[model samples]
Target: MSEFIVFDLEFTSWPGSLEQDWSAPGQLREIVQIGALRLNDDCSVVEEYEALVRPLANPRLSPYFTDLTGITQEDVDQRGRAPAEALGDFLGFCRGLPVLSYGNDMVVLGENVGWARARGDEVKNGFLSATFLNIRPWLNFIVPETADANVGRLWEVLNLPKPAAGREHSALFDCYSFTAALKHLHAMGHWLPTGFL
Candidate 1:
């Protein structure tokens, strides 16, 4: 059976008042956490992977980022590894599987790759060629009522339990929620294999 690597990421961000435009290619947000689940064809999770990545450009976690994702400077400093190491591990874990992600994970992944390249780190070419399935459009297609639903709204619409308070933005937790939503959609007779829109 084919596997799908469903994943999420948490990244560093400045406060709204101090936020710089991330329009420039190299100025994109730095990822701090990676969380993913490997799912069988039936959508049952086969394994899980989680990592905390140290930010090279923004070593200290911003207050806004901590408040939003509950990831602190201490957490990153104590538990995080270099982005290249973390991403390398992640890519290895996801080898041979199509990736599934919510929202802008692909954009962030691309930005991270660029950041790595600029730093002279050799990122895996497999990641550059990997197929990515964005869950939003597929979810919308399957559940017309949720056509424009964001993550929270999608969870509510699917009757999936709300994430515990203060845990919404963490990568692993979000992955779990997204996976639950996908399983619920599948149970309702709308199973979508990866990249099958």
Candidate 2:
């Protein structure tokens, strides 16, 4: 049996396009939230976890960021945990299971490992490593002629019910929507069962 996990992350972004400078500072991404759900080989929900992480490089949360994510400075102050420790805990919570998150940024996963490495966290190297599948690339490979590969667009293509307004930006909400979209695609015969739950 092949278990699979789905997850999403929210990040703090600096104002600029990746092409403008392409450096970390120029286009910084600080992980804010992570939401993950684990599924058994048969696609049944097994476990879930969510967490808020404080930015290590940039402590300040911009007004635009707060407005867009609905995560306020007060929220960060009240609940934000140290990035490294929080990431370690989240990974520990997973018990060495692989994760599936939207896109190929891998920023959050990298941070999850890097932050742990810095502190000599107990998780093994292989445990920290993950199997990352970019949803865009997966969709493009599966249906090359179509342009809409994101969850929002994929939902429309699969004729699945639309998500509530303003729900895409949240990690937890997006994770659930992404799962449904994938299921819809599978139902339409567009996606084969990968034997990965």
Question: What are the RMSDs of all candidates, in order?
Answer: 3.1, 3.5
Name the 10 consecutive residues with the lowest summed lDDT in model 2: 17-26
List, residue by residue over 80-146, the lDDT tens digit for candidate 2.
9877666666666555566666576466567556755766764344444455555666665665543
Candidate 2's clash total is: 0
The lowest-lDDT stretch of 10 consecutive residues in candidate 1 is 17-26
Tell me the deviation in Å of residue 13 in model 1: 1.1
- What are the lDDT scores of the predictions, listed in order? 0.77, 0.64
Which pairs of residues clash in candidate 2, taking residues 3 or more apart in a chain or in different chains? none
Residue 47 local lDDT, model 2: 74
Summarize candidate 1's per-residue lDDT along 14-123 as a digit string, tens digits. 65532455554434488899998898877788998999999998687778888988888889999998887788788878786788887868788778878888899976
Clashing pairs in model 1, backbone N/Cα/C closer than 3 A:
none
Error of 1 at 178 (Å): 0.6
